[model samples]
Target: MVISMAAASAPTTEYVNMYTLNLFSLAGGTTTSSTANRMVIEFGRGNGVVLNGSFTYGADGALSGGTLTGFEEYYAGVKGFDVLGASVPVLDFANLINANDFEGVLNAIFGGIDSISGSPMSDYLNGMAGPDTLSGLDGDDYLDGSAGDDVILGGNGADSVRGLEDNDTIEGGAGDDDVNGNMGIDLVHGGAGNDTVRGGQGNDVIYGDAGDDGHVNGNLGDDQVFGGVGADTLYGGQGADVLRGDEDNDWLSGDLGNDVLYGGAGADRFLFRAGSGVDVVGDFNYAAGDRVQLAPGTAYSLTTVGADAVINLGVGDQIILTGTGAAGAEWVVFA
Candidate 1:
């Protein structure tokens, strides 16, 4: 029973290089291959799966070990697929996994391949029907491209990454991480610290790089989030999500559908709970301090009528705050 948030700091940035997934296990667990290149696991689609050797494809296969056949083993999703994508602790599947039927964790990863896909010898690969490619280096790592269209990377520390189904691309490049793109059209990046990114259905693009705090979620579709700098918490958890709270003091949410919230400079807080359908706060910034949060017992009453700032959360849960004159009334607050 613990819930705490409100101490904000960050907003936006766009840069790409994200490559560092430090995963361990020389045989202890979490899948193998710590480095030295060569780790391919493909089958089912794309170029095609079934890299037969019966078992043992090490030595020149890179990592220099042995035995990799069919492949089939499961354990309840395994913390969302690790190594910089977040969720670490016992993620292994070398019981010689080869099953691709039930359809869940067996074919979900980089359909495009990684290390640029040039395939020096395949710098960490995972497929069974994938636009495949996987990468990881350093310490705390784990990568799971359990299906198609995959690209997973993580490094530094505290990593656990996954593109568990169709259309995937993940990057948890630094530390304090957890990434998941369980369906299609996925793209995730949480390159620094204090991170927890999730886009569990589709149409996702998330970035919370360089950081003090970031906990992002776009769990359905039509998602695009960027809160890079610190103190961030953006969740457009159903669909039609588009949030950008780029700087300090941020806590935005379009938690159901039909959302478009953006409070980009600083001092932001926009939350409208209870389904939250017709939401639109393009840049609800009144001065340098923007605010609008209502969901605690939720019996509100704030009227302006004329210019439109009606926030009556009781009956049908209406909240209309258009701008023009005294819009949103300087800034409404109810904790």
Candidate 2:
């Protein structure tokens, strides 16, 4: 049975009500009266009601007196009454709850409630207003942020979380989880295990922590990414992964392994390690000031149409030809 109550009192009055509440077997035996087995009371306003008596239970799985586990004390200046013993307060009353009241209830219950404790197949659902925090304690839970700039914590067991349409922070606590930043500038962290993260459509920051992490793209503006402590794959979709520069000069670095680098437009530069290769194909154009550096054990060939020099090298044979004249300066080496 669900019981809901509301109090109407003057600025300086104390109101109390009691009912013969049934203590069901699901709520545990009334003999387990210690604080560990007691019902948890959460108050909406700072100046609300208090639970004044203890609960009594009968042998037929029925309750004699209602359970009076705890009391909620609201600050004297606050305008609302304290909700007595309801697990979830119904603040849907008009003018009783504003944006601040909704937010205060969430902040008061951040780590205070345990949705699931001992079951592996259990799930908990919570709803809150803007700038709220939602934590999925255990059992592969799923969390959804309806609205506002919210924070979500996926505790354990390979959870899946999504931010609906606002700027949100989603964290994969400790499992092989999939996190997606649906919209807005979101921050997502794949806490541990091989996690897949996607930054939907804003300049978002994504971190792949410990395992092979893959990134989709940074759609607009400059996006920053790091594949932390693992073989990470980063893709700077549209905007340049600008390390340092001005006027659309973005930088991308493929650290460790054979990483492919591309310079799309503008005066972009490619930085490679000692054992890297840079390949150019198809009508490649070079200005007078452009330079190319070949690493050790690396080879480069160029074919020109007019007043240019071309070199072709073969096994055990060499050639050094140089001239601007039409005679075609040539040198040949024998096997």
Task: Please report the candidate that would top lDDT against the real structure.
Answer: 1
- Please give each candidate's TM-score: 0.35, 0.41
Best model per TM-score = 2
The residue pairs in collision within model 2 are 46-74, 46-75, 47-74, 48-82, 241-251, 242-250, 242-251
Per residue, candidate 1 scores C-alpha lDDT tens digits across 130-240 of 455655544455566766687777666666787888988788777887888788888888888888888888788888867755678888888998888887988888878
Candidate 2 at 228: error in angstroms?
Answer: 1.1
For candidate 2, lDDT tens digit of each residue in 1-335?
11112222223343211111111111222222223223333333333333333544466633344433333333343322233323323222111223334344433332132221211332333333345465655556566654667677777767777766678888877787777767788887777766766656676776666665544334443455545544444444444332211122223332222223332333333232332222221111132111222234534344443543333333321111123212121211111
TM-score for candidate 2, please give it.
0.41
- State how far residue 234 of model 1 sits from its true place (Å): 2.0
Task: Evaluate all candidate structures by whole-model CA lDDT and list the values in order.
Answer: 0.57, 0.41
Please give the distance, in angstroms, between residue 300's alpha carbon in candidate 2 and its true position after superposition. Answer: 13
